[model samples]
Target: MSRLATLIDEGNRPVVTAEFPSIDGGGLAAVEKAADELRPFVDAVNATDNPAAHAHASNTSIAIAMSQFGLEPIMQVVCRDKNRIAMQADIIGASLFGIQNIACLTGDDVTAGDEPEARRVFDLDSTQLVKVASGLAEGHYLSGRAIKQPPALFVGAVENPFAPPLDYRVMRALKKAEAGARFLQLQIGYYPERLENFVAGCVEHGVTRTTALIPTVVLTKSAKALSFMDESVPGISIPAEMIARVAGAGDKDAIAEESYQLTLELSRHALSLPGVSGIHLTDFRHDGSLERLVRDLRIGPAFAPDPVASASGTTSV
Candidate 1:
């Protein structure tokens, strides 16, 4: 089993995950940089494939690069760009290449990206994709054909905690869990109370015991980024105080430092919440920021030789 699968099975320590954009430029250089700078501080590096519909190197390709560099990668599979047949093929190929972690997403609308005229395939939504992936992992094809060798995968799905119709968020999570998602990566941060309430709701609905919750923490470099998230992002909620703090910062370095401090504080708060399986750090154009944060916090081992067997095992901040 992969290390991430073992961690989820043990459910003892929080798994630390970091994300990086698969930009067109830099190619292997970028992957090498992330491996050198972040591999020591993160349990897995999530290679985002054309997030927001922007074009970049394929996530699976980038994941292959990371693997070549001896780093674990959480390959993100977006449903907007491919049909079910292609999606299934990608899953089989990813597992064959030893990319065990997969994060299924319903992808942002094509209008939200640089190429608004691009065609979107949306053959399956995230839930259906999860079911397909689960079936593939169990030695059966989507067509009910038996596979000679099944892929061993750790499946994950994304959730938006602050999305409206609050109760529906937890319901969606339960639905994903029922679809065979072993872990959930939530789009959250900035509002601890909201996250706490989300977790409470999950517990009340009996979702916590079965599904692992890993909330996202974004490290914004400037007030403009926060403003964009607040204004353009549909489900994210950036507090007013955060905007004021960043806007009031006098210079560039100060703004970066302030943002870093805010992320650290928020991350610490997130770690304190109940039923939180891990924290996913989103690096918003902040080079090496995730590494610095992890090193300064002195959290548990970034890459454990083995998953902790019990709650008595070592903890990661």
Candidate 2:
């Protein structure tokens, strides 16, 4: 089993995950540098698939590069650009290169990207993709053809607790888990109460018994960035008071500090939830705060309070 798979299965301490910055330029040297910076702070980082519907370096290429540089990658495969056949091939291809984790996503609409004219593809939804990946791991394709040797893939999908139809979010997570998603990386949100309710419901409905829940939090230095996500990002909503709290912090440095504190507070609260297994971070503060956040929380492999590997759902609160 992969370290992440073992960690989640053990359910001892908190797991830490982050998104790798999208690369449009720079060679392997650039990928190496990015991996080096994040390698010390996260158990595994996501190699995103055209995040926000904007194209960057291909997820496969970036994931392979990340592995070459000693950073484990959760290669994301989106259904927006590929059919089931292509997506399955990508998963199998990535596995050959030692990619152990796969995150399936129902990507943003084509209109969300820079090139609106690009045709959209949704041959399979996120839940179906999760099952497809699980099939690959089970040594068969959807067609029921057997593979002599199946790749061991740790499959997961995304969930958003803060989005509309709030009560149904837990059910959606349940669906993914039932579809064979081993983990669910939640979408970023500012509301603790909402997250609490979602996690509680997951536990109540028994979703946590089989699927690991990893809530996502963000590190942004300014309230404007928060406001932008609130207004522009789909499936993400932030309370005005939360934005005001950071905006009122005074100078730029003060605002940045306040933002970091906010993230730490959210991370703490998320970890405190009974069913939560870990935290997934989205860093907008390019200013070394990623390391700082991991160090402060003492949860990731490098900064954990204990030298031993932990998946105990216990984090420093």
Please report the candidate that would top TM-score against the real structure: 2
Residues 1-317, candidate 2: write the lDDT tens digits: 77899988877679999999999898999999899889888989999999989999999999999999999899999999999999999999999999979999998888877888999999999999999999999999988999778999999999999988999999999999999998999999889999999999999998999999999999998999999999888788899999999999999999999999999999999999999999999988778999898888888988777634243435542
* Best-performing candidate as measured by lDDT: 2
The TM-score obtained by model 1 is 0.91
Looking at candidate 2, what is the lDDT of residue 154?
A: 94
**Judged by lDDT against the true structure, how good is candidate 2?**
0.92
Query: What is the alpha-carbon lDDT of model 1 when measured against the actual structure?
Result: 0.82
**Alpha carbon lDDT at 306, candidate 2:** 64
Steric overlap count per candidate = 0, 7
Residue 206 accuracy (lDDT) in model 2: 88
- Candidate 1 segments exceeding 4 Å error: 285-287, 300-317
The TM-score between candidate 2 and the true structure equals 0.96
